[model samples]
Target: MAEMTQITPFVNCRDLAAQRRFFEDMLGFTCGFQADNYAFLRRDNVAVRLLEVDFNLDDPARQQMVYIDVDDVDALWAELEPALSKLPEGRARAPFNQPYNQREFHVSDEGACLFLFGQGIEPSA
Candidate 1:
């Protein structure tokens, strides 16, 4: 059996340049590799693949989503809050603890893919 190493989500976007800028500028992701049609972006251990695709209005597409596990959700939120508010639909909801015991916040890119940055909270002492 082949051992599973890692899972990287591929997101389809209309413009590679815009997608690359969003990840690099807004979310602090570094571009690992880039081609005309594809880009791989990384931050710490998380990697996201972006593919350039033509948007079809006739056939509506489902939004792509990625959850980035972070060491500190609040700190990330504090850093990202100001910039996130400027993009179209880029506003982030305040971080909150979930039933799953993770404190998380949601932000969307210009491409419409949602990213949830979260940190796992320990049980109360």
Candidate 2:
């Protein structure tokens, strides 16, 4: 059997420049490669690809969600809190424990892609 190496998600956004900024400035991802309509961003081991697309933002079907597993969700959230606070209300959420045995922090980018950062925790008693 071939061993799977890594998985990178391709995200569609209305504005590539703004999306790139969100990934880099907000999420701490560095741009590995970029073109007129596409960009490859990486932070530590995770990677994401941003593609410029013409899509209806009003359509709920066009929204995307990406879940990222982290070693420490709270630490990551603290580092991003200052920047996240500048976003409009409801764009960022504080880290919280979930019934699923994970602590998660949720944030939405300018393109409305929801990114969830989570860390595994002991199951609640």
Candidate 3:
């Protein structure tokens, strides 16, 4: 049997450059590779591929949700809060405790892809 090592997700966006900035500047990811219509971004072990596309934003099929497991959700939120706050209304959300025993922070890029950063926590009593 072969062990699965990693998985990278492809995110479709209308503007690759804007998505790149959102990943790099806001999410703290670095661009490992970039081409005319695509870019590979990574931060630590997590990676995402941004691809330029022509699609309807109103289409239900175009919506995407990405969940990221982090070591410390609060810490990560603290670091990203300033940059996220600069985004348009509803683009970012503060950290909050979830019923599933995790603390999570939510944010979305220009392409409307929702990114959730979460860390496991002890269940509430």
Better of 1 and 2 by TM-score: 2
Assess the local accuracy of residue 63 in candidate 2 as a C-alpha lDDT between 0 and 100.
Answer: 85
**Which of candidates 1 and 3 is the stronger one according to lDDT?**
3
> In candidate 1, which residue pairs get closer than 3 Å at backbone N, Cα or C atoms, i.e. clash?
none
lDDT of 3 by residue, 87-122 (tens): 999999999999999999999888868999999999
Query: What is the TM-score of each predicted model, taking all chains together?
Result: 0.83, 0.95, 0.96
What's the distance in Å from true for residue 97, model 3?
0.6
Show pairs that collide, candidate 2. Answer: none
TM-score of 3: 0.96
Question: Lowest summed-lDDT stretch of 10 residues in model 3?
Answer: 53-62
TM-score of 1: 0.83
lDDT of 3 at 124: 96
lDDT of candidate 2 over 1-125, digit per residue (tens): 99987889998888999999988888889999999999999999999999998878658888889999999999999999988888889999999999999999999988858999999999988
Better of 1 and 3 by TM-score: 3
Clashing pairs in 3: none
Candidate 1 per-residue lDDT over residues 1-125, each given as its tens digit: 99986789998888899889998888889998998999999888889999988875224466677888889999998887777777765356779888888899998776768789999998655
